[model samples]
Target chain A: MKWWLIAWREIRWEVFLDRASLLRTAIFVVIPIFFVFGNRGLPGGQAGEATIVALALQSVFFPSLAGVSLIAATFTAEKENGTLVPLLAAPIRDFDIVLGKLIGMVAPVLAACAVTLAAAYALASYRYGAERIAHTLTPQLIYALLVLSLLYLVTTGSVTMIVAARVRSSRAAQQLAGLVIAISAAVFGGLGVVASQLADGWALVAVGVLLVFFDVGALEIARRVWQRGEVIGRI
Target chain B: MIEVRNVTRRFDGVVALADASFEVRPGEIVALLGPNGAGKTTASRIIGGILAPSEGDVLVDGISVRVDPNGVRARCGFVTDQPSLYDRMPLLEYLAFFARLYDVSSPDHRAVELAKLLGLDDVLAKRLGAFSRGMRQKVAIARALVHDPPVLLLDEPATALDPEMAQTLRSFIVSLRARHRAILLTTHDLDEAQRIADRVVVLYKGRVIRIGATSEIRAGGKPSYLLAFAGEASAARDALSRIGIEAQPAASEDGLAALRFATDDPRRTNGAALRALLDAGIEVVTLAAEERSLEDAYLAILAEARQ
Candidate 1:
């Protein structure tokens, strides 16, 4: 419950009210629309599939990357602004603080991803025909778009929080977050390609399992690393 | 009700606070005074349970910080030099958020009550980013008090405030003592501490060198008295010399000569000096004791600690 309160405040301040963060979300949301229209150049049947892949990639990578940037800034920004000390002084558990921040940071990014996918879906349906769009929307693709995006968010968010906790400055944290996002994009991109060529839904399911492992490992590491003493010492 | 017993904190083999022990009873304010790098902040953080001690323990209302830090923290409210507020959040919302964090019942009502008490009622709707340094400090204080904790740890709460604002804050802190909140204030401002602190613990190089009442620390040296006379300077000097009393010349007032001197026994030495002056036919107009400021005693104490 305390963690929820913390998460609510983070969402309100960092997402809804912060102009810079809102603008960043807006940019990511609009980028998927361009991807939707760009895929129109491909030939009929293959074009629909490419559009799904492209939109799903954008949907997974872009907003998760945005979330990584935001999560990475979580502690470093608090340190820079001198808010970490007071927050750490509060009675909340270190686990609660980390969990609250994780939920808070990922929620906004997921919301942005949903909006991006919605806009892209409508645009692709209008640019291409409804039947063609419907033909490409398989269960596997839908699973990839939704579950895979969430896994990617949790994995990257947790890993980036580890980097954020260790770093001294927000700029350094953001740079490291970018590096983490790039590595994630490559790994997930390769997995997507292999899943498409191999056993389709089964391969995608294996990818989801692997991401779950990654999310669990990263979350455990994050929880262990995020100690109040360590955080205050860094500050 | 805050007891920091034999607490030591080290960072990377460097001792920041070493074997420090102190107590702030209910309804008392103890000032933790030190120079730069003296570990005042470290001690405060340890007491507030923000940092674990490398050795020993701190107990807030008998809740051991080592065993249950969160429980100790729940009973303590910490305020640092910087307000460190979310600039975009309104004051009311910010206070309410902290109140809820502390699990206070009726958090919104508590926030409003604190705002009104801190004289921020008119600006409850204003965003904290637009506040001045003093106002931000007040907001920080309000947030700390929203839970109505039994112990309050204030680290340089009036670092950058204007003189008037500092006075207001000092008065407010003094008022908190009546509510029986044990307050441990860490500061570089000796005057502020002297004004409000019931007792002071002087820390030098992470060690508690002196801990005593404010007046005791201020009068840390031999007692001295000043004598004002209606006689010539040479006569006054000679009259004191006859009694084996060495008196230094002090500033004259209203066409009268004055001399200052220290005595181990004021009652005996003062009476002898006055008798000597009368015997010398020199009129002794007035005799008064000189008061030493806390700043003077603090410097002397630090100098001795360095030795």
Candidate 2:
């Protein structure tokens, strides 16, 4: 129950109270939309469709990176500022702590991703005729993109939460998170290039299912490693 | 009530506290006194449920910290030297946030009440980061008391306060005992401890050297006498030297001299000195035993422990 309270507080703090982080999220979400619309009136071809898909994916990717920052700040920043002591002193379970932080971070970033994706879709329909847009927008691709975004959110959010829990210093956690995100983006980009070749419904569903399993595995690992003693003792 | 029974805490093979046993009953304040590195903080942390003892157990209201730390924490309020408060939050909001976390029925009401009690009513809406050290300390104190816990642990709560502010904080702490709450105060300030604590436990080198009523601990020191003379001080000094007694002039007036001397037994020594002064024609105005100071007793205990 208290963890849900913490999650609510975390979301409110990030979305409303922390204007700077909100502005950063806005910039990350809106910039890619500008890029997608800036290429208006370009001739439609295989390259044009690929470019649109890449722009949409970029929108998802940036917010996913932003999710890492949110997770890092959620755990590591509290620890760094010394507020973690009182928070830990409360009658809160360790699992709830991690779960609350995950919810807190993932929600806002996913919301931003949704908005970015919507803007991308609107711009694509405006740039090309509705019929052309419909012909180009494969249902499987849309489903894969949504699944891929969810997978990225969970993967990056879980890893960032783990790093934040283990690392004592907030700055170190953030820096380590940046490194992890960079490596993840490179690997995901490679997978995306291959995924473009097999844009079938079965393959997309298979990958989505696999990613869900991976998300659960990562969450479990995070839960197991977050010992209250080691986290508080490091300070 | 809180009990720390034979608790020991070690860090990297070095003992921070050893066999530390003490209890604070309801409505009583126990001050843990020691110099730096004396394990005062470690003992308080163990009792606060923030640090687990390497050995033994700490019980708060009959709940063992080793067995159920969360249960102990729920009933304990802890205020450290530097409270880690959120800079972006208003003092009132911060209090409310913690109150909610503790599941207080009415968080805003509790926050207002705590702010008023801690003299923070005027600055309740001010950001905590903008607060001065004294203001921050008050808010930290308010934060601790927000839930009205049955026990409180304070570690050097007045580390850098001015004399006036320190006195205010001391009075406030003393007032808490009236609420029937058990309080464990850890501080290096012996005078503060003596002034506020009903009982004191002296720690040295991670070990409990002594624990008793403040007056009892003070009475362990050697007794001294203050004598007032109406005549010349040198004459009294000379006469006392002749009688094989040594006395130092503590003060002097136009026609009076005050002397101080130490003795193991005040009654017998004062009698012999008075008789000697009367025989030598030295008018003695007043003679009284000087009260033993807690500082002197603390120093004596530390010296003895060293030896």
Candidate 3:
């Protein structure tokens, strides 16, 4: 007898008008294209193309921000409209409220990430199919994709719900979400600065481990915030 | 059945509710009457399991709301005065979604049934964003009733409805009572409370100062008879007093002359007041027995309680 109708209701409006934050969805998919194939031969030997494909696979992190924004925006909008309390007043647990909202955002955001990555993979194969992607994709690479996406989601899903729950102003939420995106960009760029030295399979494994660590860390911090009465403390 | 025993809820230094105690029996309609910010909403929320009381126990059908909150919530259908319905979803889908939350299966028939009961059939497919205030209120009501919980906590159930629509809701609440659903209604409209509530609890500040069966507490002491004559106002008061009826001059100036007599027995006062005037040959132009309004009784109770 538990459900997420409130959360579904929160996200449905975003999907229906194609109005609520489609621009973020667009940016999430489009930015990876530029990094994957646009600038070639930056770090390695004549293996310029394979590195780009690897980077494209690694850039599964982009949609993480999209998920955060969707959850944050949903909460901010509901609080502004005074709909949050009535929705919360329904027969659901306090924690379940956050879970439903996170599910609403994370599902759609992850779906968009999957679709955009498919398009990116097809383009990469068309250009350098005979080389880095000579055969169909490898299990190791698929594992990396699956693990990275999972980590990114667990981290962002938790953090975004907390951010959404704590804030009052929609502008504040947007600005706060914008701050998170900025931080993510810095982290992404910081990885590039150290990429030339450790440019190999070892580096890919290292980055994968780091992403998982950060994902777990962010989720724990978010879970703590949600439990401390910050989510439903106010109106 | 619900029981709130000396529940006091405080935030920091602000007291939202203090030592508030009241009860609702099975199949009872208890309208919580108070002015804005009089802790009406806070008390209702505590009962609905949306908020916890600072220092008291709220028991619902023998289950404490704080200890087994899910149990308390499961038995309640909660509705706010305003519609915070999720936007973008069709009204019916939203209801169906809540129906699922209550683990309510076969909701297609249930939604259709509630839609007809609440007159929400016409707008079932439309998104809630498109509904008017009245329509939205109906949808909010539908959301609460979808699960058919044993208890209904309603805050201004018809706040947004028109007069006729409010009448419909009032009657619908009566029907729910017939179904043995205990209802807690909070509204500013006293007449509505007078019309539908089996009992009324008036809250002042944060405590329940007065409560009983609606008609009992508001039944004031007893009825009083009023007499009016065109001429000789003092002469009429003297004439009525001779017959052992206390005829105090209510309006003794100019063309209007009136006297008031307090009596526990309405029939005796009605007969004696009329006979004294008629036998004395006093010109009794208007004579009527005034039944104390629930309003007058309410004000007196409030004024006395505040003191």
Best to worst by TM-score, what's the order? 1, 2, 3
Q: Per-residue lDDT of B159-241 in model 1, one digit per residue for the tens?
A: 99999999999999998999999999999898898899999999999999999999999887888898999888788888888
Docking class of 2: acceptable
> Per-residue lDDT for A156-220 in model 2, tens only?
78877777778877788879888888877877776656664685635655666777788778777
Model 1, span A51-155: residue lDDT tens: 566775686567667788888888788888988787888888888888898999888788788777767767777877666766786656666587777888888
Pairs with backbone N, CA or C atoms under 3 Å apart (clashes), candidate 1: none
DockQ of 1: 0.76
DockQ for all models: 0.76, 0.47, 0.40
Q: Estimate, for each residue in A46-135, the C-alpha lDDT of model 3 and write its tens digit.
A: 465457546556557676677667766777777677676555556577666666666667777777777766666766777665355534
TM-score of the second chain for every model: 0.93, 0.93, 0.87
Better of 1 and 2 by DockQ: 1
Evaluate candidate 1 and give its CAPRI docking class based on DockQ.
medium
Docking quality tier of model 3: acceptable
> Is 1 or 2 the stronger prediction by TM-score?
1
